[model samples]
Target chain A: MGIGPVAAQLEALLFVAAEPLPLPRLSAAVGLPERQVRTALVELAAHLEAGGHGIALSEIAGGFQLLTRPEHAAVVAALQAPRSAPLSKAALETLAIVAFRQPVTRATIEELRGVQSEGALATLVDRGLVAEAGRADSPGRPFLYATTRQFLEHCGLRSLEELASLANLPPAVTQVQPLPGWRTPARGAAGPEAATPDA
Target chain B: MGSDDRGGGVPEKGACQAPEPGLESVWSGLDAGTLAPDDVRVEALVGQQREVAADLEDATAAVVQLSRVLEAKARALLPTPVAPEAEGGEPGAEPDADDADLAERVAAYQAFAEAAALLRSYEESRALRFGRPQPESKTRRPAPSPAGAVSLEDLLTALSQVWERARPRTRDVTRERLTVGQVVARLRTRLSRLGSIEFEELFPSDADRFEVVVTFLAVLELVRLGEARAQQPHPFQALRLAWSGPEAESR
Candidate 1:
């Protein structure tokens, strides 16, 4: 195929891809040389940048992907508002572990929670709530996890201490009173019909 | 009472009796009026007990005083330095440029010190597990023997042979060689990463001395020979000398 057709195809593939695509994989899919694919990607990225659409191609985690410019994050967040749910209980628990036991391994979280937490961990990572800090020195060298700055912003904390203090209640109490809004009914307040007997 | 005096003391009625064999009988024979005049032993025992009590009280007082003095001295010795605060209501405000720069330098130094300490401990532990090599001076080079002992020239030839054997059998190969300029470049790059030179450690023998000119020059020479590489990941980080050989690529 000519370079023009190949570049068009590459752009189309990137636009619809849910995750970043590696150059090798993209080359294989498009049946083009790796060098040619890279050149095309560079050209495409520049074209997008100059277009002023607030979307740019980025290299992350060894792959190329399109991402919204950070300056447009507020607008994107507003558009995504109704689709989002309040933080799940499991997510909160995982976040707590990440915040306090930061630079901790996945095994440590499993040990503390007494259950498999892979799904919750992945979810937190996907949401940018946590990140891979580094690898531990032990055998197999598992990746250490830590809460990201987004997590701090979400929790309304200027620092990790504020988050840690959430778990630092005096030992005398067996149960803690939930924060004021946390105790509200999972569903919106009972409907008026439920409060009154049916006619 | 009627007194019947016969000579000096017409043997007072009780005294006239023979003294008893034991203390009880002797006490019974003695008049109660005369006993009080001979109570010297009781007074001596009481005085001894008083002296012992006073000594014990003095020792305890001395111990308490010593403890207080020691505590005060300890407090004076290591008083926590008060952190200078910016005159404002904002807590944890961004530090001024000078303070920020100093803190960065200090943090870098602390990290380097910690890493060096860890490396030293690891080396010590490894040495303990595996016996250390004897001093180089103790091992003497063998004298060359005809057709028996290898001479220095022969040794060099053998080393070259080994190197030739190890060379990769591929075209378009990149031969990594170290040069003085390369070493200088690496050092400059590494120094940029390092927080600052630890002048004290670099020149412990001379306090007034600041820079490490000669030692650094020697390091550059070593790096030029491919014996060492300067490794530093970030600014304000410590420079590390690492051995880079063919085997190191695997690591």
Candidate 2:
């Protein structure tokens, strides 16, 4: 219905932010508690929607940003605003694997694709769709890659859970099954499964 | 629902359909001593195999479908191309190159000069972009100063020294690395419990070479501070430590 002063201040911040601002960051910036900031963000989103504003409040990449509505995307593009290039087929496939089986190593991705995906992996990382989650405890301690929050924004997903549900896979298929001679997905941090060396 | 491609695209006339073996026909065959029990068993096994194959195919198709959906979503989310800027000047206001005004002539000259400079910059930028990735290979060193500012050998030597100094040092930041204080605490805990422990027993089970070194240092500090005594009966043997600190005396 109506936005408060907190919501208005949040709107200005979101509008100017190049990247999404997380709740904690927003709270710190506004000098308010996170709970109050969250409430204001909700009110701001509602106000934008009700007012039929060209820019809408979007929770993307684990943060809030003011993004042009989908309907106005065409008009905004017509104004010569910068937009990221579309990913190649190979890059998309690599992204999908990273999204589905996160904290995965490059060797696993190559094994699944049956081809070297270095270029695609690099491109995904360059585009901010994927990032190094951590290193596996196995031999060589290869860096594990996972989809970033930007990945969720790109796919219009709220969370990794949303991406998982989108597949509508059977419950059994959802569980991480360790391949032969491969360590389980959980690495380090006293994980339940024992580490298996590469065969 | 009844008639679709689920029949594997067979015609509705059923001309290609296989003959069905009715239960009566089967009984007649049995009475006539024509059909064997093994044949029926074989038929059942074949059907089971077909069902299993279908299930496998379904699972495969589901996975393929999921991949396709993810790819489609990714494609849909791609940012739209921004429209190109329209060139200035009205369509009807065409300038004749043969009889141009002074203003147009100077403008044309300036434009030509600008284009040349822009082209050179574009080439230089392209070269830099391509060359950026090649330095990691270390196959080719930076080309000597074109103006012969210094000998190639001297330049290479100096640059190598600078590079060594400027290169960022990386360290393993995993939680596995132990601090000196942590090793000291662990030693104190075990010593207080057992009154005395061998040097080998001071190290934790997950101790790495670094941790082993730290643990040794901690024990040396305890002895140096007159808080513990190290007794080795023979050379190259485990050193036994007895706590004699203020905490131990109070206990």
Once superposed on the true structure, which residue ranges of model 2 sit more than 4 Å away at CA?
A170-173, A176-199, B1-251
True contacts kept of each: 0.00, 0.00
TM-score of each: 0.25, 0.40
Q: Which ten contiguous residues of candidate 2 chain B have the minimum total lDDT?
A: B125-134
Per-residue lDDT of candidate 2, residues A25-65 (tens digit): 78899999888988888899999889987777766445667
Point out the worst 10-residue segment of candidate 1 chain B by lDDT.
B1-10
- Model 1, residue B182: what's the lDDT? 56
Q: Score the docking of each candidate (DockQ).
A: 0.01, 0.01
Cα error, candidate 2, residue A75 (Å) = 1.0
Write model 2 residue lDDT over B1-251, tens digit each, in one string. 01112212112363764333432233233334465422332243234334533344333423332333233234335653444444784543544333244324323222222222332332232222110112233223322221122435676899999998996989987676577778787787778777788867777788778878888999988888787888887898888998887678766
Model 2 chain B TM at 0.30
Model 1: number of backbone collisions: 0
Best by TM-score: 2
What are the clashing pairs of model 1?
none
DockQ of 1: 0.01
